[model samples]
Every structure is written in C-alpha cells, then in structure tokens.
Target: MSAVTDNLGLFFGGYLRSLSICLWALVGSLVLGVLVAACRVSPVPPLRAFGAFWVTTFRNTPLSVVLFFCAFGLPELGINRSFFFFGVLGLVLYTSAFVCEAVRSGINSVSAGQAEAARSIGLNFSQGLRYVVLPQALRTVVPPLGSVIIAMFKNSAVVGAFGVGGDLWSTGQTLTSARGLETLPVFVGIAFFYLMITLPAGAILQIVERKVAIAR
Candidate 1:
C-alpha cells in the first residue's frame, strides 16, 4: 500500500500508456475488421475466399505468436519499427479476425428481403452493403463488438510481456519486484484502475445498444 501510494505517478503513467495502445489498436482493428467482413461477404468469389482465408489464418494463430513475429521476426525481414509497434499490431491482427466474424454474423442476421429490396431498386451488392445493410448490421453487432473491445482491453497486458514500455502489466511487475511480494494493495489498485475503464465502457455500450436496437 505504501509502495503504491508512493508511486502513484508511475502507475498512472503506465496505465495511460496502456490505454493509448488499446485505443489505437481498437480503432485499427475495427476498421480492418469491417473491411475483412466486407470481403467475406463480397459478391466476387475471390474476395470472399481471400477474406475467409485471412480470418482463418489469424484466428487460428495465437496472439503471442503474432506479437513475436511483429516484434522480433519482422526485423529479420527488414520490417523495422514493428518492434515498438508490435503491441499495437498484435492486438489489431488477432482481434480483427474475431471482429470480422462478429460483423459477418450481424450481416447474416439482416433479413434477405432487405437485400432483395435494395436490388429491386438497383442498389447492387456493394452499394447495398455500404448504404443499407452495414448500418443495420452494426446495430445488431454492437453488443458483440463491445465484448470484443473488453477482451482487447484485457489482452493489452500481453504487450508488456514483449518488453513494450509503460504498459500496466510491465508496471505491475516492476512495482511488485521493487516492493516486497506482499503487494495486495497494488493489485487492488490495479483492478480498480481496470474497472475504471471497462465498467464505464460496458455501460456506455449497453446504452448505445438499447438506442440502436432494431424493432424486430
């Protein structure tokens, strides 16, 4: 307790850095995921196949393996700076697979009539997905998307294991070692810090989900 109280600045700084990593990772994953989901549902056969392959490949891989490749393996191939960016990339690459699946499921949930109606009005596949289907699909996907985000928040801890600095997991390790092993207060404080982000986020998404809920 005394250790944590004395080192408030360190904890806060680490948490802030971790939050930044998660934020950027989340944004990138969502964007990539949507594009992948679009590919999975593409009217063109090749695109759909490629998208399915992408999801299967990443989803089958471990996050640690992906991080290792980004942080270490890529440099051998002259892909530099991905070491520092690995934490961000790790979350994005792994999470996007799940995100794509969630969005695709949402797309499936939409009634076939909607697409047919759009087609009747001359709205082709791409156009309908862009202007009509994705919007409705997003509403259905929010709850699952929220869950994915929360999982990403937790997974951000793995970044620290890869030596990315100023992350909460690394900070916790440093703090515990610097102090004695009896750092209950430190863990309690950390849990509080995590809940600070997750609880509010969950509640906000729940509200957004309610608002966006389809009438069906």
Candidate 2:
C-alpha cells in the first residue's frame, strides 16, 4: 500500500502531462489534417501534389523516427527544444498525415451537389466549404475522426522517448525500473489510464453521431 501511495503522484502527474501533450497533438493534427484535406481536394495540381507527397512521406515513416529527428536531429541543425515543443510538433505533424486522409475521405463522402448548390447561392469556393460542404462532411466523418483522435492520444505516449518528462508511459517505465514490480501490473495500469481517456471520448462521439443522424 505504501508503495502504491508513494508512486501515485508520479502516476497522476505523468498522466496529466501526457494528456496535455495529447490534447495539443489532437488540435494541431486536426488543423493540419483539414489543411491537407483541402489541398488534396483543391483544383490546383500543385496543391494536390504537395498534399499527396506529405501524406505519403509521413505515412511511410515510423512516428518514432519523426520524433527522433525533431528531438535529437534538429539540435544538430541549431534547432533547440524548449519544453518538449519539438516532440509535440513531431507528433502533430505525424498524426496529421493520417488525420488528413480520414478527413479527405470524409469530405469526399459529401455529395458534390452540396458544393454546386452553395455556388448557385453565390458562395465562393472557400465560403461554400465553410458553410455547406465542411459541416456535412464533418458530420459524416465524425466516427472515423473520433477514432483518429483516440489513436493520436495513444500515440502521444511515445513522446516519452524524446526525454519529455511526465507522460504515462515514461512514468510507467520509471516506476517499473525503480520498484521492480511485475511487468504485467505496470502495463495494466498504463492501459487502464489510456482507456479512461479514450473510451469516454469514443462514446461521446457515438452519441453525437446518433444525434446528427436523428436530426437528419
């Protein structure tokens, strides 16, 4: 009991810190994903090429490699890490690549008639997207996007490798090493911590989807 109490602070703090990083990663990825999706859908060939290239590059590369490059490799080029910004940046960019594909598929699921109708109403491309296409497309994509968010949350745990302190996975490693507890228990704790976040978020998304469906 004393052992658990002693480590509770570390466990909770690490979870919170990791959650923070995950939240930033979620927002950053969503933004970048939307931009990439827009580029992929744009009429401009160059924009589509750029988006495709980015998606393929990040998708092919392991995320840990991306983190390593940002955390370790960048300093070689005089880029410095200040408070794990590089780790967050890498996670965001890497996760965004996948999220982009999710969102692009979502946008594609929306009927082309929506765009045409908006254009008939005098909306420009951006305006049509903002008012008509994105809203409907977002509704269609909620379930998949929710999965992406959950996945990103889980993946953010990897930032611990970059020496970013105070993440659940890193804390688990520290506790396991110091306490020499059974590996199973430590991993169980880590898995439970992740489930606590992801399960509820997924449920919420489902609820939203149901509501959207009912409204339609």
TM-score of candidate 2 to 2 decimals: 0.91
**lDDT of each residue in 17-124, candidate 1, tens digit only:** 878888899899999999999999998999999999999999999999999888988788987784448779888999999999999999999998898989999998
Candidate 1 residues lying further than 4 Å off, grouped into runs, are 178-183, 214-216
Clashing pairs in 1: none
Please give, for residues 1-216, the per-residue lDDT of candidate 2 as tens digits.
444456778778887888889888888999999999888888789999999999999999999999988888888999886547988999998999888998888789898999999999999887887889888888778778888888888888788777887788788878778768667667777777778778877888889989988876
lDDT against true structure, model 1: 0.86
Question: Which pairs of residues collide in model 2?
Answer: none
Q: What is the C-alpha lDDT of each candidate?
A: 0.86, 0.84
Backbone clash total for model 1 is: 0
TM-score of each: 0.92, 0.91
Clash count of each predicted structure: 0, 0
Candidate whose lDDT is highest: 1
TM-score leader: 1
